[model samples]
Target: MNIAKHMETIFLASVVIVGATSMASAAVARIGHAAPEPKVYAVAVEGAPMAVVTVSAKRLSAAEKAAL
Candidate 1:
């Protein structure tokens, strides 16, 4: 029950508690299963003078999001 032994016991107990909590968290899955693919919907409206623009494999970068 010296100061050094008391501090060592507290450190060991904290390590064990943190390790067990991490293991338990890793075993959980969101929504109890894998997520489905996200769908993107598009609609075109009549405008001044804009031609059709076709794009495949749609994706947005961080810079594009910041510009919005």
Candidate 2:
């Protein structure tokens, strides 16, 4: 009986650890694929007017740009 109880405890602990690990990995995957927020900046040209520029957090490679 004692051995059975110990096995049950071990099984429950293993299940909990696996569940937590899966949840953490899922969250990381979502964050990895998430889009970055765009940044806005105000710029002033020499002897010119002010302008608003938007910068992307992520830059595309040449291949990615060509695919767009």
Candidate 3:
């Protein structure tokens, strides 16, 4: 009976630890998913004959547009 109780305690502790770890991983994944995408920039020299630039599809905010 004593051994059975010990085994039960061990099993419950393992379950709790696994559940907590899974919850933490899921929260981290959700935070990563909610993050903003990285911005892409195109660079060019001012007076270069072969200068060409491509911009990302992301829309700029009003302040950002005004600054550009």
Q: Which of the numbered candidates is closest to the native, going by highest TM-score?
A: 1
TM-score list, all predictions: 0.45, 0.42, 0.42
Alpha-carbon runs more than 4 Å astray in model 3 = 1-5, 33-68
Candidate 2 clashing pairs? none
Please give the distance, in angstroms, between residue 7's alpha carbon in candidate 2 and its true position after superposition: 0.3
Reference-based lDDT, each prediction: 0.80, 0.87, 0.88
Q: Residue by residue across 1-68, what tens digits does model 2's lDDT show?
A: 57776998989999999999999999999878777698768565689966669887998899999999
**What's each prediction's clash count?**
0, 0, 0
Of models 1 and 3, which has the larger lDDT? 3
The TM-score ranking, best first, is 1, 2, 3
Candidate 2 versus truth, CA RMSD in Å, comes to 12.9
Q: Per-residue lDDT for 1-68 in model 3, tens only?
A: 58776998989999999999999999999877677798869667788789569886989899999999
Residue pairs with backbone overlap in model 1: none
RMSD to true structure for each model, in Å: 10.9, 12.9, 14.1
TM-score of 1: 0.45
For model 1, the run of ten residues with the poorest summed lDDT: 24-33
